[model samples]
Target: MIMKATGIVRRIDDLGRVVIPKEIRRTMRIREGDPLEIYTDREGEVILKKYSPIGELSEFANEYAESLQQATGHVVCISDKDNIIAVVGASKKEYMGKKIGKELEKIIEEKKTIMVDQNADGKIFNILEEQEGDSSYLSQVIAPIVSQGDTIGSVVLLSKESQVKMGDVEKKLAETAANFLGKQMEQ
Candidate 1:
C-alpha cells in the first residue's frame, strides 16, 4: 500500500471530534454531510473512507452494463463519483476499478449528457487518467446519474469501431441508463 505523510495534526475537542483539514477534504472530495466509514487496523492505524452509495449497487450496475452493451453493441461502463465500478466490453480489464479522469468528474459535477466523436477535437478527453491522450475510441456518450438532487455517478456508451456512429439513439440509451441507476439509488 502507498502511504503519504501530510505532517498535519489535529486534536479531539471536548466532544471527541477532530476536524479534518480543508485541504485534505478537498483532495479526497469529501463534502459536507457526506458519509465516511471509519476503520482501525490491529496495527493501531486509523483509516477513513468516503462512502459511496452507488458502490452498493455494483451488482446491479454490472448487470445493467452487460445488458446495455448487448443492446447497443458497444462498450458500457458505470462509474461512481470517483471510480469506474462496472464495465462491459472487450476493454473491461482496462477500465474496471480505475479512477475517473477529471473530465468525467466535471461531467458528473455539471450533471450533463454529452456525446463526442474522434473528429470533433484533437482527442477526446481520457475517461481514465491511465489512458491519457489515447484516442482509440471512435465515439462516446456520457450521462450523469443524479439521485435526490445530488449527482452521484455516470453511465457511458463507447464505440471503438469507426463504422459505428454514436448518435441520438446512443445518447438516449446512456441517459436512460443513468436515470435508471439514479432512481435505483433512491430505493
Candidate 2:
C-alpha cells in the first residue's frame, strides 16, 4: 500500500473510535499501547501525532510553512535529518524531502547550527542572516516546534533581503505551532 500525505480513509462512529493505519503507527513509532495526541488548527485541520519531539515539530513546521506562504510571498522549506522533507508556498518543489548530503547538506552539517533544540518552550524566534547568491544578506526566521525535551521539526519563514522580520504575529503563530506540537507529544 502506498502512503499518502493525505487521503487516509477514516470513519468516526457515534462512540468516537478512530482506527489509525498500521503504516502511520509504525512510521510514527506508535505501538499498540503507545499514546497519541490529537490537535485542531485554526483552519480546523485535525492531526494525530506521536508524543515525540521530532514527530510534533515535523507537523508544526509543515503547517507553519503553509501559513507563512499565505502571509508572505516567500517559499518555505523544511528539512529533517538534512533532507528537505516538505516544501510550502513555492511554485516548484525545489527541495522537498531531498537528502542534503553533498552540497547544502554539507554546509548545514559543518555549521553544527541548531536553530532551536528540544525543550524549546513558548515563542522563541531566531533570525538568521544568510549570504545570498548576489552577495546580499537575506534573513530567515527559524522556529522549532518542541515538546517533552525533543525537537520534532522546525518552521522556516523566508523573505526578501529587506522584508524579513519576526514580528508579533509571526512570533505568536510560531508559539501556537509549538503548542500544537506539545499537545501532540502528550499522552
Candidate 3:
C-alpha cells in the first residue's frame, strides 16, 4: 500500500468528530451521505475506504462476467460506480480493478444503455481513463445497473473483432445482465 501524506491534520472535537478535508473528499468522490469503512492496523494507522454496495458481490460478478463472455463470445466487464470489479475474456488483465472513464461514469449517472460500433458514428470510448488512446475494442454495449432507484454500477459487452457488430441482441444482453445484478442487490 502506497501512502502519501497530505500534510494536513485535524483535531477531534468533544463530540469525536474530525472533519475530512474537502480536497480529499472530492478526490475520493465521497459525497455527503456516502458510507465509509474505517480500519485500524496494528501499526497504529487508520484507513478510510469508500464503501461500495456492489463491491460486496465481487464473486457473483465474476461468475456473471464469465457467463456473459461465453454467451456473447466477447469481453464482459462488471463495474461498480468507481472501478471495474470483474472482467472476463482476453482483456481481463488490462481492465480488472481499473477506474472507469468519465464517459462510462456519465452513462451510469444517466442510467441509460448505449451501443457503439463502426457504423454508429464510430465514437469509441476508453473503458479506463488511463487507456485514453489505447482502446482496443471495436464494438461495445453498456448498460447501467440501477438498484432501488439508485444507479450503482454497469455491465458492458465489448468485442475486439471488427466483424462483430454490436446490435440489439448485445444491447439486450447487457441490459438483462445489469438488471439481474441490480435485482440481486435489492435482496
Candidate 4:
C-alpha cells in the first residue's frame, strides 16, 4: 500500500538538516523528539521513515540471542514482559508471542537475574516443557531487563545440552544482555 505523496521540499541547511512541514509532521504524529529513519533505494531515492524503537530493540534481541548462543552453545530467550520476543537454539516458532507468566513476572518485579541448574520443563524460565509434544528447554538463565530503574522485561538463556552451571562469567554476560536491552529501550 502506498501513501499519496504530499511532496513538500525544503532545502537542507548548512548544518545538514531538512525541515519536514508541519502539516505532514502533524499527520504522521512526528513529535519534536521522535526519530526518523533514512533509507536509500538502489535507484538513488531517499526515504525518511518514522522509527519505531520498540521494534528495533526486539530485532536487536534476535542478534543478542545468536551471539550469546555462540558463546555458550546454548538456547537463549529474550522477552518483553508479556511476550516471548526472541529465542535462539530452540524451536521458538511455537513459543513466540506466548505470555511469560508468573515466573517471569517475579523476575521483572524483583529486577534480578536467576540461574536455574535443572528443570524437567522450563517452567521457571516461563517456557513450556512441551509445545506440540516437544520439550521447550530444560535449564536456563533468567535475567531481568531493568530500564531507568524499572524492570521492563527479561532475557533467558537455556542450556541445550546438560544442565548449565551459571558461573560469574555467564551471569555477567546474561545480565549484560538484559542491561544492553535496557539501555536501548531508554534511547
Candidate 5:
C-alpha cells in the first residue's frame, strides 16, 4: 500500500544490509518478524512487498461458504477491506469486486458485528437494503475479521426468510470465520 512519488535510495553494507525507514515500515505494517517477498520484474527491478496470505484466505472462505450453503440457505460473501473476494450460495456476480460502500465499511470502522434486520432503521439498514436491491433478504449479518486488533476484512451472511431466526448463530459463524482467517494470517 506504500507508494512513492520519487525513489529513495539506501546503500547496502558489506553484510548486504539496508534499513527500511521506520515511517515506511510503520505505514506498510511491516513488523519485525514479518516476511518480505523479493522479486524482479521484466525490467529486472527488484520489488519488495510485505508477504500476504490473501490467496489462501480467499480459497478457505469460498470453501467454508460452500460448506455452509446447505445449512444456512443464504448467500455468503467474504470481503477484504475493499472488495468481495469470495462468495457462495446466491449468484450475485455483481457483488464480486464491488467496493463495499460506507454501509458495511462501518463494521470495519467500528470493529464489531452488526445486524440489519427487516425492522431496523438508519444508515446501516438503508445501505444494506440498497446494496442488496431492496431488502430481498430478511436479514444481514456482518462481522469484522480482526487481526492483531485491526479489522482486515469481513464475513457477510444474508438470510432469506423472516420466519427464520439465526441472529446468534450467524454472528458466531462470522466470528468463527474471522478466527479462522486470523490463524491463517499468523502463519
Candidate 6:
C-alpha cells in the first residue's frame, strides 16, 4: 500500500519564485525555498518531500550578533583585514572607524600574538597598540577571528567600569563573539 504524501505545487512566476501550498508547507516543515527532495515511483508518480539538514554556521550569525549586543561592558567589532565587516553593540561605530584596528597586521609583522595585560580591566578595546593612553583601568579584550588555518579578522570588547573584576563572564562573551565571527568567515 502506497501512502500518498499529498501537497499542492503552485507554479513558478516570471521571477522564478514559487509559492508552495500552505498546508503542504506546514506538513513538511518547509519554510521558503527550503530545498525539496523529489523522486518517481515505478508508475512514474512524483514524490515530493522535505530535505532536512543542518546548514552552515553563518546562517545564524544574527542570533550571535544579538547576544553580542546584550553582552555588557564591551564594544564588539567583527572585521576583515581591509575594513570592519560588522559591529555589535553601542560602541560599534567608534571601534569601526579606526583604520589601525586590524590586529592581524601586527601578528604578521611582529610574528607574535600580543598577550593581554593581566592587570588590564574594563576600559577600551584595540586590535593593536596605537597610542599609550592611561585607559589601563578600562576593561578591554580582543580575540583574533581565525578559522580553517587562516586569520580572517578579529573581535574586541571594552569592559564596564564596575567593581566586577574582569572575570570569566567577560572573557566568555569576548570569546563567543570571536568564535562566531570565525565561523561566519569560514562559511
Model with the higher lDDT, candidate 5 or 6: 5
TM-score of model number 4? 0.62
**What is the C-alpha lDDT profile of model 1 across 99-119, one tens digit per residue?**
898888898889889998886
Name the top TM-score candidate.
Answer: 3
Question: Could you give candidate 3's per-residue lDDT for residues 43-101 as a string of tens digits?
Answer: 99999998888999999999999999999999898999889999989666788888988
Candidate 3 TM-score versus the reference: 0.91
lDDT of candidate 1 at residue 86, scale 0 to 100 = 98
Which residue pairs of candidate 2 clash?
53-152, 54-152, 57-153, 84-97
For all the candidates, what are their Cα RMSDs to the real structure? 2.2, 12.5, 1.7, 9.3, 5.8, 15.5
- Model 6 over residues 1-187: C-alpha lDDT tens digits? 5676555446869997666678766554455645567888899875665442212333344356556757563545554443444556644555443444434445423322232433554234345335345354355555665666555555555444545455566667766666666665566
RMSD of 4: 9.3
TM-score, ranked from best to worst: 3, 1, 5, 4, 6, 2
The weakest ten consecutive residues by lDDT in model 2 span: 126-135
Question: Lowest summed lDDT over 10 consecutive residues: which window, candidate 4?
Answer: 127-136
Residue 69's lDDT within candidate 3 is: 91
The CA lDDT of each predicted structure is 0.89, 0.50, 0.88, 0.72, 0.70, 0.51
Per-residue lDDT over 1-187 for candidate 5, one digit per residue giving the tens place of the 0 to 100 score: 3546537678999999898878788656566766678987787777787554554577787887777666678778877765677878866576765666666766766987887777455222322313745456778878787777766678888777868755788788777877777667777
Angstrom error at residue 54, model 2: 5.0
For candidate 6, what's the RMSD? 15.5
Candidate 2 local lDDT, 59-156, one digit each (tens): 56577668767776655665543345556765334456444333333333343222322223322222222312321224444555455654444445
TM-scores of all candidate predictions against the true structure? 0.88, 0.43, 0.91, 0.62, 0.66, 0.48
State the displacement of the C-alpha of residue 97, model 5, in Å, after optimal TM-score superposition.
2.4
Rank by lDDT, highest first. 1, 3, 4, 5, 6, 2
The regions of model 4 sitting more than 4 angstroms off are 1-56, 119-125, 128-136
Off by over 4 Å in 2: 1-64, 99-137, 161-164
Clashing pairs in 4: none
Kindly report which residue stretches of model 6 are placed more than 4 angstroms away from their true locations once superposed.
1-63, 91-93, 102-104, 107-125, 128-137
